[model samples]
Target: MGLLIDGEWSTQWYDTKSTGGKFKRSAAAFRNWVTQDGSAGPSGEGGFEAESGRYHLYVSLACPWAHRTLIFRKLKDLTDHIDVTVVDAKMPDEHGWTIPEGADPVNNAETMWQVYVAAKSDYTGRVTVPVLWDKKRNTIVSNESAEIIRMFNSAFNDITGNTDDYYPEELHDEINEVNERVYHTVNNGVYKSGFATTQEAYDEAVTELFDSLEWLEDKLGKQKYLAGDQLTEADWRLFTTLVRFDPVYHGHFKCNIKRIADYPNISRLVHELVAVPNVKDTIDMDHIKTHYYWSHTSINPHRIVPKGPLIEF
Candidate 1:
């Protein structure tokens, strides 16, 4: 919930006052790309050549954005090619994101912010996860989850031999269309509702949130997946949000219009994805619950984690 100001750590929560209680997320600062031949793919500086055992991932299991990279790593068989280090689930005020016991593995920095500062001495913005660090360069390649997953999707195909493309060329137009809608209305909508400081903001967010959810319900009912018969990036992108909706977001984040369990298609979609080979192994309920309830003191001041959701997935 906090960020770095000129590389100095500040415990300030997101400022929703200026936006009239709207919680607008900050754009990811590091946007370097990792290509097969180190050529620039879309944005940022190049030379991040894709190599086995050269890149490491930093993520929080609780974070949906970070969860995207974890799933892509498993699905694309980059689990061994790129090593990962999970941050401590607890977000104590004194320690924003720490490695409780193990070594930093990547840069040997104790906290996540230190890792960010390692990238840039005076970096400012939210200290987010799903950071793709290049050990060879000794700097962060990218912290943007979408791009990180794209790298994981194809960059290491030569080594992993798992050429399962989630973002296919033909469906790019439709998938991006669905992604834009889902990112605003659903993936980030729940946070907007909970973190909002104004009634108007919450109302607008919740309305869009459920509307998109219902649209998805109808979409899934008709088609096998969001983009089509093939399960593309669109489906996995929506999944991390739905998987946490009931267990945490429903009650914790005030996204209480309806649970995923209420929608048959979504629930089936969740269970189906969870049943995938390594996808289930990526889910850690304890980390998800602890991070939300324990952190975000503005939302849950008492810092008491709840029990008894009893989710099947």
Candidate 2:
């Protein structure tokens, strides 16, 4: 919720006044990549080779984007190869993400802002999770979740010996198309709806969100997954958001026009995805519920988290 200003931490929320009450997310500051060789992968500089013990992943169990990287790591069988650290679930925007003092073994830094400070002394951006840190270089490889997951998909095939490709060659175009629509209308749409301060902005976001949901319901009704019958990265990208729909977004974020349970297709897919090996283990309901309800004091002033309406298949 807050961001670093010239390597200095500041407690601030997004000012929706300028955008007419619309929530606009800032782009991730770190964008380096880890390829099989020392060559550059896409954006940032090279020298980040695929090594088993050279990288460490920093994530929040509450964040959907961070969840995607966790799923990829588990699915690709990279758990033994990569080290990971999960931040505390009850993170507020004011102090930002932090672990207990002397808890983190990698950096032993309390706040995520300190991690950014380690990467760049004058860093200026929202300190988001799903940061892929190169332990050797002592800097973040990338904070962009999309790019991080892509790196996990193929970067360490040599070390892990799992060559299963989520982003396949035959389905690249279709995968990108599905990913684009889902990213905007469904993945980010919930935030746009919930974070809006004006009626017009909320209306626009909710309409698009449900419209995309209906489209997904129809699409999933026919195929076993998004991007045809084959499982792809597109499916996992949307899965994190859907799993959270009824539990968090429905009541907490004001995205209650319809729940995922209301749509039978999406609900079934949610169960199926959860049943996937290592996926259900990645989902932490306590983390998800606590972060959304307790952190957003604007929505739940008393911080009285509801106990009923249990999430089930």
Candidate 3:
């Protein structure tokens, strides 16, 4: 809910007034990558080689973007190789995303912003999660979860020996295509609907969101997963959003045109994904509910967290 301006932390919500009441998300500032041979990744500098116990992941369990990387890390069997530090669920006031006392172990820092400041003295931008920190380099390898998951999918294959490719060579084109649509219309759509300041913007966002859901329902009805029969990265990417829809977004974010349960196919798909071996362990309902309700003061002024609609399926 806050941002860094010229490396200084400032508590400010999104200025929807400028965008005609439309909520616009800031692009992630850090886009570095981790490669097998310490070579340069797609965007940032290299020297981040694939080594066991050399990298630590910093994430918010509440964030869907961060959740994707956690799923990838678990699916890739990198749990033993890479370490993790999770921030507290409730991010309040000017102190955005602080690790309450014993929660953070890596730097023992109070705020998540400290990690950014540690990475670059004068960095500026929204401090988001799923930051891949290189222990040896003493810097963040990447803060972009989308790219971070890709790195986890393949970059450290040699070290981990878990080559169950989610983004396979043959299905790359299809997976990318699905990912593009899902990211825009569904993944980010819920946020657009929730944070919209104007009725027009909210209506537009909700329409697009449900439309995409209908499309997904149709697509999933035919195939087993998003990209096809083989469960691809695209499926997991969308799963995070879908899993949270009914529980948090539906009521908390006012995205209640219809629940995920209303769409039988989508609901079934989510349940299937959640049933996946290590996938269930990645989901923390307490974190998901608490973070969304408590973090956004603009949305919920009193910061009163809800405790109903107990999820059964």
Candidate 2 per-residue lDDT over residues 1-313, each given as its tens digit? 6889999999888889999999888888888899999798779899999999899999999999999999999999999988888988877767889877776678889989999999999999899998999989999999999999999999999999999999999999999999999999899999999899999999999999999999999998998888998889999999999988888999998999998999988888889889989899999888888888888887787777777568864
**TM-score of structure candidate 3:** 0.97
lDDT of 1: 0.91
Segments in model 3 whose C-alpha atoms lie over 4 Å from true places:
none
User: Which lDDT tens digits does candidate 3 get at residues 147-179?
Assistant: 999999999899888899998999999999988
Rank list by lDDT: 1, 2, 3
TM-score of model 1 vs. true structure? 0.98
Worst 10 residues of 1 by lDDT: 94-103
Rank order (by TM-score, best first): 1, 2, 3
TM, every model: 0.98, 0.98, 0.97
